[model samples]
Target: MNFRDYLLPADSPRIAAARGVTPAEYAQRMLATEKAQNLQREWQTLLDEAFRGITTHGKPQPDLFHLQDEGFDNTCAVNAARALLATLSDEHHQRVCQPVDAQQWRAWYNPEIPFNDFGVRLEQTSVATREAFRRLLRSCTSPSGFEKINHLMDANHFLGELYDLTNIMNRWSFHFMIFGEPSETRPWGWNIYGHHVAFCCFIIGRQLVISPTFMGVEPNIIDRGNEHDAILFTEEERRGLTLMQALTPVQQQRATVYTLMEDPAMPPERFNFADQRHLAGAFQDNRIIPCEGICAAEMSPVQRQLLLDTVAAFIHILPEGPRQARMAQVLRYLDQTWWCWIGSCGDDDVFYYRIQSPVILLEFDHHSGMWLTNEAPARFHIHTIMRTPNGNDYGQALLQAFQQYTEAE
Candidate 1:
């Protein structure tokens, strides 16, 4: 909520000190002093204005997509979102969903953000409704994609056990929300968000853009003997290493910015001091990151494949059709992309790598302690994100393009 309601009077000592005013004889200061900055009004204003344009009702399609062609087919996903909405009561519908243009679209936070008041918490919802929501998740993402999300949740629960926190930190504490009406012809999106995980999937006709995705965890492994080899972020870690090894000395020299990752004393070129470990992380939707590391065109054929494969590890999370469409875009921009790295290229070294292109930006980093006790950044702590820079995240760009195309036609 807006904090304006709790604002102190203008004449308050703290306010006077901040404004460099001596609170002259309780005079005109009263006018400005009494106006305590509160957020309750502004908060509601944002809520009411969030999704004012998107239609309240929508239908299947209006020639915005050609699912039969080389693009995407979102019929299943569209139906699933509609099905989930049908299962909800009017109260739940109002609470759990947002309009396509809602500001809540940008309100998502990974574990990095402490705000907990947004989105629909699945565990807090009725059982029948929760089950129906999962069905939508299943329909939108592949089985493997859904599995990875659940694993992240369970890892959050595991962390809670170590930290002695409440059930709010449990595996099922994830939040869900839909933006825009579920219509085949219209552009809309949904988000599944919570600690250590935030998936922003947007749909514009037959195209999908899943970006500003945040995936990370503490104690990145499940130590339970029951589920042996329960690990996450390994493919990302391994593929990044594979690409680094495939690079020649000259290429590595261009890509490797620093041997000691995140060292404050390191030169500005060696590390991004602002983000510390990961750039384009949470709350960084508008970060301007110039190309770093070596371009894919500079790599050997094998190294290029490794780079593309590493990218696939993130894009593969999309359903088959959308994944293929997005992968095609990655290939189209292969020459323009940069593959940069920090930290060690040694066999067992904690490191960071970023892949950025005109259409995509992916970051993988081994971070130091936040939830864990590790002082040095380790393989056990991982953070990875896939973003579409240049304001295309959430398919907003594509939606605009589609609108223009139809208007011109």
Candidate 2:
């Protein structure tokens, strides 16, 4: 099902009525909630399977012969040590001591820190070393004879300390999100913290040469598989790129936007000219495009003609421009004429395609605008859609363009 379908209201009165109740009460009353529950169950099943393999292969215990104490055959101490070591090597120890890096450590230990703050801490260590630190700390312990256990603990917790600095940095990086007077502040802070933690954990795993059951489960965790196995891009990338390609040269010059798409099922033939219309239709039907204002004031008559001509060739043409003057002002924001594309899939039938590129697509409804209802107070909407090889949504074609453009240079 489409994402919009999920967002839209259902026709069932029982379901519609439930929406009025508190989320807790609604969940208790709805059958549709089972979908989420079922999905969770499936996720847990996969996790259990992956964990089973990790435990069976990654258990940290010694062999049966090693369990026999060499010097303390008669002492109970040897047996105790063997038991302790076995427990440590058990599945739980590896799970807790899972390799992590500075980013993942910060995230797992200090999610309150901001990105800018985290970046500062990251500056103190190389990505590789930060990962090593996470592994060391995860397994570190103070010996009984050590007089400076406290100091040792402090040293061990340095990664967490660095994460604290990240919190301060984050506050500065996204001051607007943090300090804005909105009643409900966005959880950008928490999101960054979680991302950092995951990234750190990934780094630790990499340094320790431990493999995660999932891809991108850790930071710097490169996917050694084919591009088709990646998950970074989504349908959103395609929609974004389509709009980006339609922008006039002036528009491309000013704005800096990045698009990312993740679709594993995207075959090479999907980029052919014959498939362009189908792709364009998919974007439009999905309504994944974001609406943003465009200024077309700066375009000379010839430039405007070129844009219209280029766009006209595509099956799906998104209109551009408010007036000649507005187009000129909008052209100053775009930075580069580049796009990125990727595709990947999962173990299931699920698939995705991602396209990251420059594009501008904006929408403004009347209710949100300053002016109340007016007879003709600019009630129009502006849309800029493109689907040509050069116009955007041409993933495979762009590769060819890049090669040709580079060869010519």
Candidate with the greatest TM-score versus the true structure: 1
Best by lDDT: 1
In model 1, which regions exceed 4 Å deviation?
1-73, 112-116, 164-166, 227-229, 265-275
**Each model's TM-score?**
0.79, 0.19
The global Cα lDDT (0 to 1) of model 1 is 0.70
Ten contiguous residues minimizing lDDT sum, candidate 2: 204-213
Model 2, range 97-156, lDDT digits (tens) per residue?
312111122222211122222222322324453343333322221122111212222222
RMSD of 1: 11.3
User: 95 in model 2: Cα distance from truth in Å?
Assistant: 21
Q: Candidate 2 overall Cα lDDT vs. reference?
A: 0.24
Per-residue lDDT tens digits for candidate 1, residues 238-313, read: 9999999888888898998776776666666334322356767545555456677789988888999999999988
